[model samples]
Target chain A: MPPKMNIEPEPGDQTPEVGAATDVAPLGRDHGKPAHELTAEEDADGTDWGRVAGESEFKGLLASKRRFIVPATIFFVAYYFALPVLVGYAPGLMDTRVLGVNLAYLFALSQFFMAWAVAALYVRAAGGWDETARRIIERLHSSRKEK
Target chain B: MSTPLLMFLIFVGITLVITYWAARRSTGSSAYFAAGRSIKGWQNGVAVAGDYMSAASFLGIAGIIAFQGYDGFMYSVGWLVAYLTVLLVVAEPLRNAGKYTMADVLAYRLSPRPVRAMASLSTLTVSTFYMIAQMVGAGALVSLLLKDSGVTYQAAVVGVGILMIVYVVFGGMLATTWVQIVKAILLMAGTILLSVLVLAHFGFSFGNFFDAIKHVTYHAAAGKVVTQDFLQPGLRYKPPYGALDLISLGMALLFGTAGLPHILVRFYTVPDAKTARTSVVWAMAIIGVFYILTTFLGFGAATIVGRDVISKNGGTNMSAPLLAQAMGGDIFFGFISAIAFATILAVVAGLTISASTSFAHDFWTNVIHRGTERAPGEEVKVARVTAFVVGGVAILIAIVLGPTANVAFLVALAFAVAASANLPVIVLSLFWRRFNTRGAVAGLGTGLLASIVLILLSPSIMTVDPPTVTGAARHLIQSPPLFPLENPGLLSIPLGFLGAFLGTLTGREPSAEARYTELVVRANTGLGAEKATTH
Candidate 1:
């Protein structure tokens, strides 16, 4: 088993023993619990969400994410639109032969590769984001431990 | 229907049997809605692919490419890239933040009651529209496949409707997942076989296949003679407006996949956020390969078998199956027809479960009951009943509309609704910390109304042909569309985002700020996410 990461139950919350037990036991929607109550009541067991959301680590997570997703979205939209745009406005260039086929057909085929490549790249970068999130989560636990 | 009617029955029988087994294990709401969240990564992957690959994306695109050549492929390319949006923006956050429906995520920081009601409205509209499109396709395709077996279009539609309802109401998500897996396998197998046969015709050389598609002469739908230069674009849509139409279509598709409720719900079936992320990639790989081969199937049908045969038989949707008959003769035709039936069955079931889950979980439990069901099994029971009602309504719509009622355009409207109405709220709720319940409601309402109004005013609904010439009054107005575009995504999507922004700036809810932090924490890190329970 992996070594225990530094996390602790909040003051007046469930004991660490109780927390471990509930992890395996199945729980329903907590029907009696009002929707807002669950999050607000997390004061007894959960981290300081306001701090986490505002922290430099969380901001960095969002920034790095935007760096990847925003550019990725723009590039994909442009690349995909290029096919219809070129084919519609410049059929001559689109139809120009490359490797014994229409450039439009070849370009359209390349989109499959492009999509897969971009998806793979994002997945790779997301690992770092995951790491940053882990750091934030660990900080939440360690600070609670200190308290 | 045809010799394949028995094969179709056999496939249904298997699903029904699976339904019987799943029903026992799916008594609770979570199991009914999300297969108890017990589905593994790869299984959910295939299921997601199965849920997504719908008959239109498979056989329909082939027909389009067969008839419209390279232009049909423009539609296919957008579809693959669309999943990138899903991978980058929607998948994991949705899976982590949601419980059983997309509303769970969208309504997280918003006022739960009103936001959920609006979200449910958007979900139901999208589901019904998409379901109707598939039902129409199923109706047309089934009758064609079973033509020799005395099946009428009405019988085929009712049969499909009843079977899908049974699978959803009885079996719920488990039965739906298994059916999708089975259908995904069958679809890929049949496609691979057909692709191989098509390749064999050209001595197994990809070069020969490309070389030959260029010279083969065939009749277009309008009876004009056309050759492989049909491989060139502009055959379907001409310049200016045509190019604009293409751009709008790409927008709807690229954004639409990320918003589709049925597709979004599939992510919730997995174990965690990471698995949800992996499943998108899995689906992308399977769907991408299938799409590339489908284009090949269209070329084969257009070149080797000729468009005259395809259009004369049953329009473009029949291109792939006809190519199967042309290449492998009668038995292969039967086999392919059965696979097509399974494909339609799986997709409609997926749509049904998502719709019903939203009705019972969001509308009934959350909205009507104020976020609490009276009993453990009550929500699941209500969901089953909702599935029956939803299925019945879909059957009536598909039958009343009939087989020739522009299924593709209806599908486009479905995507347009999803992109404009649903996606904006979902995206803003995640990233924009200031987005409140007012913003959610405004965005959804504005997007929903704008998309519907645009479609009603658009050319798809408003035909240019005179009633006297076309032999039918397509619209009360005889002139061309006031809204020039067929798809409203180009204009409506912007309006959706604008409505959200305006609502945020105009409205105030200090409560939104406090919960926003908690939601972001859950949405990003997957801490405190709802966990799956054992059956």
Candidate 2:
């Protein structure tokens, strides 16, 4: 058999400490603590995995994100499909005038307004979601430190 | 007395004022590169719109529509829809992850050195291709407007280059943003005015307008329908695409927007990932409307203006200018021309700034200056110099290439490069945890090399016969049977993914999952801000 190989850990690796810790030891002590006590300590230590995992605020924010995605996708895809059809099949439809512009021109221009409206809607809806998400993250972070 | 010149002067004056103000405000690197990250959400949204819309949108698409009929609209649709991909995949992640360039985001999880170097190289490549296209377009616009003024295309290019260099060197993002904002508004207004006039010509009757276009048809020439072919009494309307060209064009637009570096950097100007997403939604809305107007302008040019005029001087490319000349006269023509010039300047300025920032912040400061906390003032100085260097290089390339190359072809090459070099790395870095530094380097290198090689061998480059490569030899080697299709997206994008995957498998796994996870969380949730309060 060939000589045994040696593999060294990278300097950037801080994973050994975080990953290898099987039991929560008390602050300033070497003794292992109970799991429930560890949980409270984890929160107090401001690295609370439980709070981060259980945060409902993030769920709410994600829900809003999903809502925005669904509608925006519909509008954008519809517009994309509309292009070839309007040009190839409904040539006459585009030529019809609206506000001194043809239907095609009007629709193209309207797409911008629709985009702005969508943005405005996003801002109004997402503004709250972003703030709430920030709050939950902060709260969890603070909780982790206290333990 | 000419409205065009007056409008042009007015815009120049406004831009100058903004530049001076920006110069005063920009004290260090952060201010020059990213507006000190204090720019409001909505303002950045408008600036994003300004940066994203280029001469291609203002002139190329409209001109294409006027010349090629529906095919032009296909380009417009492709351009706009690609933004959705940007919104979904790139914007928020990009904004949240890194401080400056797209490379910053890609290299965040890895060692800074190699990642920054590679990312800068990609930025330079993409920026150079994109800048050349913009310059070429600018030259064309100048030539069209000043054909009778004794101004050469070279002079036009140089003049625009000077304007762009000055804008970025002195004013930074402030100058870039203000010019873009003003230009965006003017472009929209000009198109809106032209649409109104076109409608008025038809007595505001949409039915009559459609009837006019329905009767219009062009004879097929060289397998491509020449719009002028239809002007005569007997010609028939030949559609621009049969099937193949449509797919080729659609794929180009779809992947192209996702890859553009200048546009991607705009997301960083916003406050957070959420704002970046919102800004994209705004950019999409603005861009969507602009494209729709272009379609009308194109059809109006085709129907109202005689094809004989447009075809005589450069065919479809001159359709919009000719239409402007017809409807608005010398003054109106000058006004539109000036706006077009401003459009080029604004875009080139933004591109130069983004490219330079990638070099300075991502490469020089982050990668090269690793282990050193970059002085605030020094970072800005490096970026400014990089801007000058990038701008100078672009000018040299533009001069070498001259004004003979097609603007659309250059733009397509830019798209191809962006898709190949940047997109694969960006996508993998976000989704694949297995993607390591080696994987990123390989993917970037492979994608870039493959795309460049494909483009060189493709019809565009091969068709240009040189003494070194005889016509017969060129033809023999011109079409590679392996990748019969010229577009690299269908080939290179996959290669990028494959290269990245292989690199990951061969490389060592990242040893710092906890820290990496923490960084990702910090990037995603702005968790680092809490640390700031504690400190």
Candidate 3:
């Protein structure tokens, strides 16, 4: 048999009616007991006291996500804005050669590689912040059980 | 029968067989519409590549390179890079949020009615433009290949339309995916093989190839470049923009790939978010290899066959076919031609399916079935019917417009429409939490209207005459003509962004920040699976 579920339904919970009674009976038997036992013991010992600290820090991490967005927007705008003028008027300015390839071909190809690199960088940077927020949220949820 | 005709018959037979198989298995809407969400990651990944790379990549890029030289390769690079954006930001988020179409994601936070309605309109507009472009491309490909057979361009467009509609009406996504997979494989193999043969003929020396090109002095006035006379050249040919046009073309290539709708819909087929991410990586690899091979083919066409001989008839669309005939005999030429035809078919089918899904699922089923508790199977049936209707409409348009307009030009216009309308709404909805439903609707409407209005009033659309050497076409409408720009991406993309931002400021702010936060958390992490039973 599966473990019992201990999570109580909130007021006016809108769980689907189709398979509700039968499904909840198995879930209660499978998951309810261990979860309730764990919360009760933790509550007695005040084990999850750091939730307040975690919530404040999670808020700080969310603020940093805003910082990366501005620089990214600036880079994209400046890069794209120069395109039409360069294509229309400054073909001669790009006559210099890089390796066997001309500056024109080199710059064009590099833009693709650059876009990918920037996206990877954003993922790496933002991913760190997102992870921190997730951890903080997890910590708060556990602490709320103790309270 | 000629080699191209023989090969075309063979591929058409294979496509028909696959369609029959798909139709037999497609009992209900789920199987026909979303393939019952049972498609594996890698399979969907290849299908995505097939869907994304249309006649634009297979035929248009090579044609552009044959005419314009090194600048054309910039488009290939730009298109490949756009996938990175799709992989990182769009693929997983889209798959996680919506069960089927783009409307699900757009309206997830808002009321189903408004969200579905606006999303459907955006989808229809984007899809129609895209489908018209594909139809135009198909017509051009048929005309180019069958010009010697004494077939009119109108007949060719009608022929392709009939074939595509037959494919869609029978098989749906299953048929489309299989056709795309087969076509993509054939196209990659054909290009790769031709590139090898071209390089081998030139003694496999890159330095020698470049040296050979230096001797070729292209004559613009006579419409032929003199290749043999290096010591004493007859005429000097100079392209208008030396380098800057490279950057403009490159920017258009890069962002335009990300803005495509048929490509975006492929992400929804995967089973989970992680699968979507991995699928993107696979697509990038396949695309990178294919593009590198195209460079070899482009340079080979320039050096070996000589542009003068190829452009004897008209334009660069025939350059690759001519080069194939030169390097390899009639057999290889026929194979390449057949693959090109398949490329057109696969791309058109993908576009038709995406458009149909948007109409049936997003517009009718979601909007019309707003309060109803219809089964998922019923929705799929509606989508399949919508696909057939859309295909019929496209065929009619292609037949009607076959005489005067160039299909390639129409394809470019579609890209411009996609970039102007869809890109803004997608980007804002993901990043900007303040963007309300009213704001999204307004931005989409404005962006689409501006692009359409600009395209209609532009010199290219008005003159309808082929652009001449001296650029001597008079504008039909005299009033309110601001810039001579052909592409509306320069103006309309920003207009879309501004409209959305301004519209958001005027509307009431959504009170579902906490709900959005919870949804976002579920989407980003894999925790939603655990909570499925709770709902």
Candidate 4:
């Protein structure tokens, strides 16, 4: 078995002995307590969540996430709405035959490819965010152990 | 039995067997509500696709395209593009923070009882509207397909409802997930085969296909034969209100998907936030490809089957099945009809579970009992009871409305409510530090009321139909519409955000500010997430 992690129970919360007993049980690793058994008030019992949120790493993570997500969202919403707007107001231009089909149909078809491209790009960017998140968690665990 | 009825029965039998196997494994609340968080990324992705597609995408959109030309294909685009909202904004944070339902996240940092109450109310409203449409559609399709066997619409509606309840109450989320996965696979195979046949009918050439589409000959409404360009826009959404309605509908679909209770709950069935993200990617790929192929399904029907024949055969919704009969004969028709039946059953099961989960977890356990299950396994019991009640109610309403009812508006209203009510509060709770319980309550209440009220005043309900339209098919109101747009998203979404902002300014809650730090940490880092069960 792997060595026990260094997470501490909150003062006046479950005893360490009780935690250990539940932790060794079969099935879920949530110390024998299912998610539905825990109230929302008790969700952050063991962690110093305020400190973690104030950390520079977390802020950097949020900033990078916003940087990728904000522009991507704007680009897609604008690109998608352009179809209905142009089709509604400028039917003549949209009706011009491009290759074999009309521009209206071609523009509508392009939306599927555009959505796929955006999703692929987001998936690529999210990989870096996942790595950053891993580092932040490792640091928090190590800090808890030192204390 | 006819070939189609035999094929449909086989599909139902297979799903019942899966439900029976899954019933044994679902012991606790987590297993029942979330499938024990053991679902893999790709599996959850396919299930999400299955839940999202519904009969609306598979049959309704195909019929629309076959009838309305370019305007009909817009629904396919909005539906697929909506996933980008799911992927970029909501999926990871939700998986990391919430437990079983969407209200779990709202209850995390805010006051539990008030927020959970409003959220549950909105969830139930949205689910009911969406479910009625599917149930009515199922009844209509089944009766049409099985007319030779003397099965009535009411019998088919009850059959679909009972099967949906059985899947939810007995087998729970595991069974629901597997049913969705099975349905998704069947739907994709059917779509791919039909698309290929459509291509083959055009001599395997894009030029030949477009040439036919350019000159579609059919009888117009006045019984005059006309040759028209099917690829051009403005066939269905025409003149004064059409432009604004299209834009409003676009906004609803783009934002509404991320807020859907059924779709959001699928994220919680995954092990972690990363897996959730991966699943969203898989869902996008599958949904995008399926929608793109609607180009073939819709246009192929218009060119090959002809609008005149489809109108006389089974109205608009039978375009896909009729095209199948024309292209690959009767056996293929049976196969496609069974796929459509499977599609409706899978979607209703997804909706029932999500609705009942929210009612039990958010409203009964949290709101009424102050966040405690009074008895062991009481929450699951309540959810099971709720599923039965929900399914029974849907069956009754669909039968009352009859087979020919216009329920396109109900699906549109579902999207509008989800976008306006659920999405705004979810975004604020995750991002804004000042957001409190009041803001969530206000957002949910205002968004819910605004969408419904606007829909009541909009063209969907108020327009006058010609004297030829009769019974359940006519509009609810005979007067001219007060609201021009059919969908309420253009105005209601902004009003929802405004309500939340105004409610936040009404009070200063220091505790909510303090807890925002905790919520941000858990939402981004998955620090205190529930672990996946090991077998």
Candidate 5:
């Protein structure tokens, strides 16, 4: 039988409606194969996955990831698509000289820097997600000891 | 031997040594498929970049930009920015949830068999298409670069194919990853040196470089001398359907990159989600710089080597190597040729491993054997055989197609399939609670069929070739194009999403919906994520 999980909800973390169950067995053996290569017949990894997903911390993690990713995706896509659209449709504006090379060239050059900036920003944001994820894992470990 | 052939031999020697060492270590499925998930962030990042910046990006784009001007640079922008999708959407979750292939993530939430079958099929299809393009490009380019050494196109194709097969069949992912890292370093060194040399030729003045590009004098048709403005857009993509075509191409590169099976499989080699994320950042930095440097490589070739000379010597693909010769003479040319060859070899190895991994891990084990290897190390053995077969087939096709085929469309088709078939299902399975086995199967089938059919009808395949166009360069179908656009991404991607959404409404899989929470928890928090094996 699986161990009963008794995870303490952190401050602002929601209490899960369903209690953690002990139905699935722990996947103790590595068998040399990676996790995904293990038999599909196993229902779970002996963890109360539903209750863990219900925690506010996991919700916050998803929300935080979404908050950064959605906007960044939109911005980069817009910024990237603008290059081809403007170059193809508005040749005159793209041809206007700026500092020496044309606007089309400058606009295209800025994209490299733009990608770097977004990537750097996402890396910084991901650090916060990493911390949140760490706390959640700590709770899961603490809960597992309750059995 | 010529300098180019000698340099190529030296590269082959170094990579073979890597293969020998890796073969000893690759004893099991984990090592063969994911390199035991032991690769560090920066190393994996470099390897990812190496896997990505194929012969198309290095030779094809440079050639295009050298001749076509501002329009050709559009491809560079799309490719680098496309990494944003991989970073923001796919990489971390993939690393956390998947084992060896992209199908791992889907198999987590949906029914395993059908999804794995479809995903494996798509992976093989994409890999095969992309590999053939590189193989053909490698054959033609190697033959041209080493013509002085008496290497024919057939010899080059066969040599590249055999080397790639050896890498995957023996060394596995460890050798392939190391080879990519080595190639990435060499490629960067070569590109930077060439860029600096080009700048120095113009006395290191941006103004001088731009001034030269402003009025590039080239001999047009019938020996007519024309001074064209390389800074201006519309030289290559022009009129009628040009705008739509460029947009379609952009959509393909943008959405298609994250879905590429080879690139997706690289994340599995890293230890964790954070490492996957960091590696992508590293790749972005390297890839971004590399694409930006194409500016100098392309324009410098135009202003210095002259389009007339490049065309006469070999073709547009020779622009970079010929520019190297014009600037730093034959030694530099040979060095650049070696870098290009390394680029091709590394990418082909990457493709071979990913395709074979999908087949062995997804189809042979999960779909066929119900997720258990019948014997110890059977998966690895199967992957090795698949690699041999895949490499052999690529060689045969590249040879049959010969040197002058317009294979640029094949790469585009690969990207379109990835975007339409792979990306939609991946995104839906990850985020949507309602997505189930039926949805996934439908999405893959619809996306695969739509992209392939649209491409068949599109300008790329259906166009009428003029009388001057003959042999391999001639259009496959000699008729007017039924579909206006060259790339099928714009239409096929939406069709894939629609198929997935509608297919979900047709059936109720309560089991799949129940597993959604597990998938999300595992994906976002990395709980139960595969650990790196300690040797």
Candidate 6:
């Protein structure tokens, strides 16, 4: 074995989703080789991926992502920026007393919480998204191998 | 000379050692551009944070708050929220799709030549403007720190220019990444120390700190007395267009960060999409802590250092260092000043490599060589020459423009170009299959032109304050601005998106549309993405 940098994840574990493409591992690893040495087999058998793009699962991935992202972006942009907009237009409401600090400071502090929550939520949701991408790649590889 | 200059030499020495170490690893184009995609997630996370926080964020935001009060905190809130856009949308897709430059993604489904040419133009323009701002800011800062120590501003400008160029020429991306990592560590430590000192001064009570911020008073430009109630807004925003100006500036920062060519290219340094995702989280966490502490630093300057002295010594940019001097005398001041100097140097080096890489990889080889990259090691040679030229021009411009040039406007312009020009194409080409070569060209051209023209006509350029007007502002029409708003993001971003949609409807490139399926699968799954080359 080459004394690889420990920066890499455990060899096959990183590719567990594409586990079906194990037969094509040698061809894919040829990316480190010179450009001309990259044979057509890298695109022929388990490597050709055009069929995977057209699958319904792929379209569903896009749709589901849009479903999460569209609302999240709208909510965060509106909620976070509302502090500045309201503080500009309606100063009295923001200046209303709470603790030693004013209402404006409280609202500003909440934005940090909202950002952390949203980022954590997305990372959690993306696990499922990654699984779907793996299944699509695996299915394409298995079909190509049978051929 | 003094402790600050001595400290600066030590900083240069450390980076030189790192550059010598990196020079061997950076022989091939892949290593030079993407560090062979070998950087670990956490180290890259620190480097990315370093790239994002300029001296402007560290010194500039605190100074703005010290002078302007609660309205200055708005920048912190807006800047932090902006990262969500990067994390939620841009990070993973960009890492998987791009190899060296953002042009890789933009030209993936388009005609490589014209698409790359336009992408390269936008990249050079944004990075050049940003580099000049950093150079000029360094000159201004050096003059303030070395008042009677006999170092001229021109010498300061040349020294910074030479140091940054040497790092790129000798070290390339690997050296740049490590410099950024070290700088980030130093900045975070300095900020934490300053915050702790400020809290101690207030009896370690949060209430006392807040009370002091509410009570500090400053002399307004018009000779009126302004008491800073640090929690209430509008010390800077005074009615009418104040709300509009706030929104426009907010929109630019929120969208601009994701589109920055330097920032976007950093994603390619890591090995996989998962690493890219984690990097964003780590960067935001560190960046958020720094921004939040600005409130303490700014308030400490206002109440402790006194507004009159800060403004008299070096304007708003000197508040943080002045606060350090007030807190711990001259030694702390020297340490803080050296970090400020290193901050500017690291950021400019990052900008230089990104701009040079786009020129060679995107335009010179892809456009001129017809994507062959024909001769071995040719791209690396072209990139080195371009880095030297870019650094030289920035030095000449900084020298001629002098120390006090009003170049802060250039930072806003750089952000505007990134958000308006570069961002629209990256988004559309990745998600919208019908987006064609014509649409990519149209989006880029419209965004670039719209941002430039609007900024020229806007209040920031037109309505310059009489006391500080110099260079082009002295000869320009000085009155009510043709465009009422200061930032043009609200108008230009929509125009970019509209141009893309209209161009796709008008121009038909069937081959470009046909390649969209492959681009989509490759970006989503990393099926045949470029792998890290062997050592």
lDDT winner between 5 and 6, please give it.
5
For candidate 2, state the interface root-mean-square deviation in angstroms to 1 decimal.
7.8
At residue B233, candidate 2 shows an lDDT of 14
lDDT of 5 at B95: 89
- Sorted on DockQ, best first, the list reads 4, 5, 1, 6, 3, 2
RMSD of each: 6.0, 10.9, 7.8, 5.1, 7.4, 6.2
Which residue ranges in model 4 land beyond 4 Å of their true spot?
A1-44
In the predicted model 1, the residue pairs found to clash are B1-B146, B2-B146
| Pick by lDDT: 2 or 5, better one | 5
Candidate 3: tens digits of C-alpha lDDT, residues B191-254? 8899889878869876676566445545655666455422111111134422333443444444
lDDT of 2: 0.68
The 10-residue segment of model 5 chain B with minimum total lDDT is B526-535
lDDT of 3: 0.65
Each prediction's fraction of true contacts recovered: 0.69, 0.15, 0.13, 0.73, 0.82, 0.64
**Can you write out model 1's per-residue Cα lDDT over B1-535, one digit (the tens) per residue?**
4558778888988999999999888767778888988888888888998988889988888988887788888888888899998999899999878899999997777889999999899899999989999999999899999999989999999999999999998899999999999999899999999999999998999888888777778855477876657578887887658888888888899888899999999988887788888888888988898988977788888888787888789978888889999999888888898999999999999999989999988999999999987987889888889899999999999888888776566788888888998999999998887899888888998889988899888887776665454432255356678887888899988888888888888878888877888888887877666666565
**What is the TM-score of candidate 2?**
0.79
What TM-score quantifies how close candidate 1 is to the native fold?
0.91
Q: List chain B TM-scores, each candidate.
A: 0.97, 0.89, 0.88, 0.99, 0.99, 0.97
Least well predicted 10-residue stretch by lDDT in candidate 2 chain A: A26-35
**Candidate 5 Cα outliers beyond 4 Å, as residue runs:** A1-44
- Over B255-323, each residue of candidate 4 has an lDDT whose tens digit, in order, gives 999999999999999988999988998999999999999989999999999899999998888999999
Docking class of 5: acceptable
* TM-score versus the correct structure, for each prediction: 0.91, 0.79, 0.80, 0.94, 0.94, 0.92
Alpha-carbon interface RMSD for all candidates, in angstroms = 2.7, 7.8, 9.3, 2.5, 2.9, 2.8
